[model samples]
Target chain A: MFTSIKRIVRSGFVGFWRNAFVSFSSIFVMTITLLVVGTVMLGNQLLGTTLEQIQNKVDINVYMVTTASQESVLRLKTSLEALPDVREVTYTSREDALAVFRDRHKNDELTIQALEELEENPLGASLAIRAKDTTHYESINAFLKEQQILEDPSAPVIDRVNFNDNKEAIDKLTAIIDTVERVTYIAMLVLVVASILITFNTIRLAIYTTREEISVMRLVGASNTFIRGPFMLQGVMYGLVSGVLTLLILYPVALWLGPATESFFLLNIFNYFVAEFGRLFAVIVGSGVVLGMISSMLAISRYLRV
Target chain B: MIYFDKVSKIYNGGQSTALEDITFQIAPNEFVSIVGHSGAGKTTLLKMLIAEDRPSGGDVFFESLNIHSIPKSRLPQYRRKIGTVFQDFKLLPHKTAYENIAFAMEANGRTDTEIAENVPQALELVDLADKIWNFPSELSGGEKQRVAIARAIVNQPDIIIADEPTGNLDPIATYEVVQILKKINDLGTTVIMTTHNKGVIDALERRVITMDEGRIIRDDAAGKYVL
Candidate 1:
């Protein structure tokens, strides 16, 4: 058994080099397939992170009336924070809001002069509310509207509750993101199918090139297992080599694009790749090997019947 | 011993019958030559012997066991008992002559030491000791055929089938190949050869089976080229 395995492995190595052109092309095609798969995965990761960042920026602001005291505002903040759907509620004092506005328009002299002309600060103290999920924002807004502080005229603690002025645009953006995610997943599925077909054809052609050799092996009293062992091993080798090649190509591209993409999307793609290196390697290499073996097995089956 | 009991082969779904009602038997260690014209089913008969093709009718028996009746899994083991040399040589282009001979032994699970010990001896038997490392592409027609013969006999099979083994060789090369086949036969290996050369057929002076249109017309002992 040990001898058989040794012969099989040696024959596989020899067969790879013997049919160098076919073997090289098989590896080349497999590498391209792996690259497509890897790129799609990375794109999905980037898209997910980008969508999360956009969702994190979204929040509802509740502006308090001028008469509302800081104690009451803090109480409101604490109550909002206690809600199950709310992630956090931050309190901004009127002075703090004014300071933020001044800092934002620091370069505009007219805005600074106008702010100074006002004898008192005009900005209202507010509670900034964030929801645990982007979909929960509507429920949290409804919960705020149902509060007694906003409805009771006697209390008159709440002034105006602003969720987002361009709610239509936000909804559209969310819809677009969902559509893109769905399309990306579909595209990945299509690519996977295409890769399998291409790899299968490539291996089939390679086996065709060795049709004569296969017949000779069969005529010489070689068993089906003996004849098949080398080809299967060759297939596995193609997958393993192509997987490593894909990673070699992917790592550099990810590294180069990391800083550049971070500046534009505010997400570090390279860090994500590095952090998930073990899983990504398994996925890429495992797919490559399995694909190679399956294609080879299917291709070689036609000739082994004799 | 090999026996063919009323064997017949029809190809293309009975559109053509390559062999019909063929019956023959050869004792162990007997050298036999099968002679026929191009479409006389010589190749078909050889294929049946190796189980490369099943007879459409009747049975081909090798030592009381029907060749076609063997299970698919046991076919390789059965084929290993018989060595075959083809007209085309059929040597693998990428393998050296040494590797080619070793390959036949390797198929039967011979050890490294066994292969190392016997490959050179097999090459020497075929007078190709010096060209052991030469690939098929790098060898001459005669040398390739010799390498092929070496590969066939390396496994020390009970019977050797030479299907027009000297078809591609010149006169001198043909003589050398015939002499090797005769020598192997003398060494207790049954050799069944098919040929068109009148000189080779006349020189053999052994049992000759002649066929015409898939039917054996004559089976003569100490036969000549009397077509």
Candidate 2:
């Protein structure tokens, strides 16, 4: 058994080298397929990073009445923090709000004088609320609205929630995220399926050229495994070579696009590629080998029927 | 020993019949030649013996095991007992003459040392020992046929089936191939050959089974070329 396996591998190498042109063409086609897969990986990362940056910039602010106690506000902050949908809630005391207002007006002399004329600070305490997911913001906002009423009805502690003012922008970003994700997933699926088909057909054509040889092997009393082993090994070789070639090709491309992507999308693609090199290798090279094997198996089965 | 019991073959739902109610038997170490014109079912009969084609009726037995009834998984083991040579030579173009011969042994799971020791001897039997390193394309038609014959006998099969093996060879090359087949038969391997060449059939003076259409018309011991 060991001897047979050794011979099979040796024959596989011999066949690969003997049909150098066909093997090269198969590797070339498989490399293009792997490149598509790699591009999808990078595109997904880029999209994910961009969406995360946008999500971070979105938040809802809540204003408290000037008469509201700091303790009550802190208690509300604690409750908000306890909510699963809420990622964080930051509170600015009335004094801190007044200081921020004054700092903003410090650049304009007239605005500074107007702020100082008011002896009591007109600015209210506020809490900035961020949700765990962009889609979770609506539930968080509803939860805040339910807490708008205070136990002391005479003094309304909650003055206003800024959710309505930012609703359009938040909704638009959420929709864009949903649409982009759906479109990207579908596009990636289509590309992967198409790549498999193209690679399968290319390998099929290569096998077709050697169909006569396959029959000869069958007639020579070669078992199905004996006939198929070399082709499968060739498939694996195509995948291994193409996988490495695809990665090598992507290296310079990622480097060239690194600065442009970093400036425009706020993520350096080349850095990400380097950081995820191991994972990328596993996915791309692994897929290449699997694709090659499946294609070869499918292509050679018909001839083995002899 | 081999037996063909009423082996009949019909094709395309009886649109054509390649063989009809044919039967024959031969003991071990016999050199049998099947001769006929094209469409005489000569090739089909060879195919049935090899189990490459199934007869529409009846059965063929190789030493009591029904050749057609052998399961697909065990077919390779059964085929290894017989070496087949074709008119087209059927040598793998990419393989050297040595590799072509070694391939048969390899398929049969022969040890590397055995292959290394025997491949040269098989090539030497065909008188092309020096051309072992040459690919099929690098060799002449007769040389390729000889390489194919070497491959056939390399594993030392119980029987050698040559189907119009020398159909593409010239008179000199044909004589060389006939001589090799005769030599292999002398070494006690039952050789079943099919031919259209009158010279070969008459020259052999061996058991000749003559066929016309799908039925065997004559089975002669020490038969001459009689159509």
Candidate 3:
């Protein structure tokens, strides 16, 4: 058995190297198809990273009424922090808000002059709210708005404001990313099919080239498996080599694009890409080897009953 | 020993049988010749011996193992026990003549040392030892036929089945090939050969079986070209 295996492996390698052009072309085609798939997967992951960053930064800012006491606003901030969904609540005093406004306009001469002309600080003290999940922000905002401490009975403790202004644009971005993710997955599936077809055809051609040897072997009392062994081994070798080639094409591209792609989005998802490279490599290689073996197995099994 | 017992073979959608109740038996180490016209079931009988094709009716026995009833998977082992030479002289074009003979020994699982010793002896037997490294394309018609005979007998099988062993050879080349098969037969290998040549069959003067339209018209002891 080991001798047969050795013969098959040796024959496979000899066949692979002898048909150098065909071997290179098959590997090249597999790499190109895999590259299209790997790039799209990486792109979609980056898009998810961008969307997640944007969602985390989005929040409902609650401004207290201009006449509300500092104590009332501070007490409301504490209550906001106590809520289950609330991740953070910062109490920005009126003077502290004014100071930020002045500092932001320090480089803008006209805006600084306007802020300096004000006799008293006019900015209202407010609490900034963050939630555990952005989807829960609506309920959290509603609860804060309905609070008796935030609402003034005499003057309404909080002023009117809306947090749903960016709703349409955010929804559109989410929809686009979701659609792209689905399309990318489908595109990947199609590439996989093409890769398998190409590998099958390539190995089929190899079988044709070695048909004389096959016929001779069959007649020489080599069993069916003995005659078909080298071809199957060739298929496996092609798959393994192509799989490694595909990963070779993917890893460096992932590494190079990591920072460049991060520039397009709010965060660098390349780290996630790097972390997942081992897993992705395993899957791609496993599929490549499987595709190779299956194509060989099917092709040889169909034509090589001799 | 190979025995064909009332074996009849008919192709599907055909009106006539290829072989009609052909009964024959040859003892161990016999040199036999089968002569007939084309479509005389000469090749069919040879194939049945190797279980390459089954007798449509009755059984073919190779040393008491019913070849027709043997499972397909065990057929290779049956074939390996018998050497075969075809009219085409099926030497691999890519391999040298020596490699062609060596391949037969390889298939029979002979050791490299045995192959090394036996291949040279087989090639020398056919007087093609000097042309061992030449490919089939580089060799003459007679040389290729010799290489094929060498390959057929290299594994030292119990029997050598030669279907039209000299169908393409000239008179001298045909004599040379028959002499090789005769030598192998003398070495205790049963040689079952089919041919159309009257001169070669008359010279062989061995057990002759004659067939016409699938039926063995005559079987003679120490037979000549009776047909």
- Residue by residue across A1-306, what tens digits does model 2's lDDT show? 998899789978987887788788878878987897899889879888987998898898989999988888898899999999999899999999888888777889998888779888888899999999877888888888888754477866778888876778878866886787788778767866776677677767777887877787778788999888988998899999999999999999999999999999899999999999999999999999998898789878878774
- Interface quality of candidate 1 as DockQ: 0.57
- Tens digits of per-residue lDDT, candidate 2, B163-201, equal 999899999999999999999999999999999999998
Best by TM-score: 2
Candidate 1 residue runs with Cα over 4 Å from true position: A18-24, A56-171, A185-210, B64-66, B69-73, B93-95, B130-140, B221-226
Winner on TM-score between 2 and 3 is 2
Candidate 2, overall lDDT? 0.89
Q: Rank candidates, TM-score, best first.
A: 2, 3, 1
Docking class of 2: medium
TM-score for every candidate vs. truth?
A: 0.77, 0.89, 0.78
lDDT of 1 at A63: 94
lDDT of 3 at A103: 84
Model 2: lDDT of residue B141: 94
After TM-score superposition, the amount by which residue B154's alpha carbon in candidate 3 deviates from its true location, in angstroms, is 2.3
Candidate 2 deviant stretches above 4 angstroms? A149-153, B93-96, B129-143, B170-176, B220-226
Task: Kindly give the number of clashing pairs for every candidate.
Answer: 0, 0, 3
Error of 2 at A302 (Å): 3.5
Docking class for candidate 1? medium
Clashing pairs in 3: A65-A157, A152-A156, A152-A157
